[model samples]
Target: MQINPPGTVQEQRPDALTKYLQHRLAQRDREGNLRRLPQPTTGIDFWSNDYLGLAAGAAATGEGTALPCGATGSRLLSGNSQQALDLESFLAAHHNQEAALLFNSGYDANLGLLSVLPNRHTVVLYDEYCHASMLDGIRLSPVKQAFRFRHNSAEDLEQKLRRYAQPGTPVLIALESVYSMEGSIAPLAAITGLAARYGAAVVVDEAHATGIFGAGGTGLVQQLGLEQQVTARVHTFGKALGCHGAAITGSRLLIDYLVNFARSFIYTTALPAQAIDAIARAYRYIGEQPALVVQLHDLVSYFRQQLQERGLRGWCDSITPIQSLLTGGNAATRSLAGRLRSQGISVSAVLSPTVPLGRERLRICLHAFNTRGEIDLLLNLLSSCPNPDL
Candidate 1:
């Protein structure tokens, strides 16, 4: 046996685990879908979730000034603070809910809620395009069964609810108010109607809709007058709010239940004081500047009009800040993104297996800060590009 010096680290050759990992990565590389972290770049804003420009603006306001950097411990322990509690109260009122529970991010909120809410007899029927976090949460649960309905299709959801939902058994319906990829708005009224008829609880992920919709950015659930119909609503701050973390709004009983049973919330360290303060400031800022939301909507309308005037077709139907244009195949979608980036425009290309294999698209996000001239420049390039390989 060979031995090394006492302080020297051992060097080992590649093992089966290393080879397996390499093989998986190689497969993805061959498929033209290898994922990599992108370097930060500056240009016209067309790719971020910051719809209201609050992230930079709030930072300029010194929202998190002179605060601690870390939470110290989990919320169940020494991490909990009075500031957190006060912020929760403010969020509850802002969202028109009896109570609100905070989580580190939208993923954690969804995972924590879905994993605990379902029992062995509970059935979860979710939209096909629901976020991966929601799907992972359902997978972690002890729910009786889970099924995917067509994306934004009330008829398909109703069919599954009719077939699978049994009498006296709890049924959880999951969907997003505004889809991140497709930029399509959910038919909340029709879905809520079905939920009421079948006695199912609706859980709406208002991540993309939270900071851009409703009066004072309350979200689509409130904008459409469906707050009372929703059992729970998850609003993420990293998007349009220009902050970080997320909150689940619901009945006081629901908040209490999650506090006791949700492992993600119970086990993880709470958000730091700085984050909590920033969230509060963001809300206050939006409340004071209602015109920000109006400006964003006006920009959305302008974008659509430009697309029509340019006679550019194939853009997905969307009335929100998130807009997608389908450019099928990984090579084609990535090529399109490269072309845009070359022109000093920052945009994201959604490729498989994020979406289905043939459903690759370019996800373009609009913001209150974006100008019509910048939008026209983006559209001019898009109109000139050749058709993508499907």
Candidate 2:
């Protein structure tokens, strides 16, 4: 093969590549689809995942005490500290599971569980609207057979199972207890019953439901008393628990399998001691304050009522913290989000790719810490805006 002379560069210039990328970025900006990382600011905090306002709480404000910023090692190694173990145990007991294994984040937990646990003879049946992490995990799995059913449609799921269920093939039904974008609850009991009939195992991702549903925020499975039916339940602490990290709750054998075989768990650095401590603290806080959950439910009801009164009830069919106002196009959604931000509100514009094109909307998350006045203000702002066609 012919080769370039020593010290001679290729005809294709690096600047050309840079210019092309810049052009694409400029196009995105023109289309109102360019995403920018915003610096942390003091605003009417509504965009964050801090559902209970514990992230900004007094735990970080104690005199002469500083929280560690990060975790330095993986859980399989030196990271398997006492704090982490205690938190895992606490979660297991609280959720009524035989064991619990913590991961770096909800994403990692999903990745670890879905990717590693399912064998070649296993088939995964996931919800159509399951989170990205779960989808990614399934993609990484060796199990060649994975199918999706309509969101929360037990009948649809049953049909899919009937089509694919076979002897000696383990069927794992993967779904979320509470969908993140839609804010709708899953039919856990019905799904579990069907799974039992089909000899399938159920895996529930309780990222959104944890710390907001069930007794002491154990999760939706616990709320519905179907903990024993679910083979694996992923509980995330980032949302309502007001902390970081996630755990896969199941039988002790399942935990052992994941601990030994999950690449995402085995290859990654573990959560820090402080993060583990925070998780423990958050669980304790939730257990000690049952009234917080009551307050949150009351607030959600009030918000829904206000939405109905303002004639904006058609925006979403959610009674949960996540409420979407479908604005259709990316440009319109971005414009609406900007306008809300200008009014000192923080709502995220769920754009194309994060959601499907033409289904872009604003994702408004409610918090127990958010006042009634803030909710009213949000509704009042929405009421004034020209209604985009549903």
Candidate 3:
């Protein structure tokens, strides 16, 4: 075989697969919808999901600890530890569940739960605006049928349930406590009521609502007192709790089933002791400081009041920290975000296919630590723009 000289490297050219990938990326770029990892910027924090401003403190507390940096194997193997078990116990009690099982992340939790829980006899009915992880999980599941209901629409969900809820077929209803893009809270009470009537099991992904909604930051399922109705709830520590990893709260039977059959949890290494400690600390912190949630709600209210005062429209009616300004087009949304970034006010321009093509918008997340002045500045900048959408 001929080889390159020791001092020289051979030139590499794009293969067919590489060329196809390049074409796809080029198309995305041309459409102004190419996504890039955000560079670190020293700007006012207005885009992240840190609603209670807990990420930094929780992570900082975990730093310099004597805990292990890595888990050696999956929980079923050498990675299992007492700390993990204890944390799960705490989570179960805190969330008013009979049991809890930890997964590496919210995506892992959803994937492991949805993919294996529903067999060929089950049908999945999900909200149209559910998170990507939930959708992906359902896509990978072996369910005989899956259908989407309109976002937070109990009537549409009822229609689907009526159509699909048949004898001998188990129905699974999937929901999010809070939709990521629209920032709208799911009508959990209504949705759960529907599930009860249809004899369906409800699974809620409370990734965005965890650590900001209920008593002691449990979740909206608990806040609405619908814990008894929901079949399972996935709470993630990465968002409001400002830590990593996620847990699914349900019956002991559900947890046991996941332990035995969930591929994502069975195959992946468990989270490190440090991350578990961080999550523990975050829960304790939130429990001790009740003002964080109040402050966050206050900020959201103030922002909304300012929006109305400034005659700015096209905002999503989200009571949570997530607030969206509908900019309508990919280019316009990106331009608005870029303009904010230039002024040291960083926000996210959520574009399709993250959202529908015509529903592109700027996602502005409010934090407990964000001040009224910062809100004013952001609104002032928007007021200066001549976009009719605003």
Task: Give per-residue CA lDDT, model 3, range 290-360, as digits (tens).
Answer: 99899999999999888888878999988889999999899999898999999999899999999988999
Cα lDDT listed for each candidate: 0.82, 0.78, 0.81
Q: Tell how far residue 232 is off in model 3, in angstroms.
A: 0.5
Worst 10 residues of 1 by lDDT: 1-10
Put the candidates in TM-score order, highest first.
3, 1, 2
> 1 or 2, which is superior by lDDT?
1
Off by over 4 Å in 1: 1-65, 388-390
lDDT of 1 at 98: 79
Deviation in Å, model 2, residue 317 alpha carbon:
0.7
lDDT of 2 by residue, 227-306 (tens): 65777899888898887889998776567667666788887867766788888889889989999989988999999888
- lDDT score, candidate 2, position 2: 22
Alpha carbon lDDT of residue 8, candidate 3?
Answer: 26
TM-score of each: 0.83, 0.81, 0.83
Model 1 earns a TM-score of 0.83
**Candidate 2 Cα misplacement greater than 4 A, ranges:** 1-72
Better of 2 and 3 by lDDT: 3
RMSD of each: 17.9, 18.4, 18.0
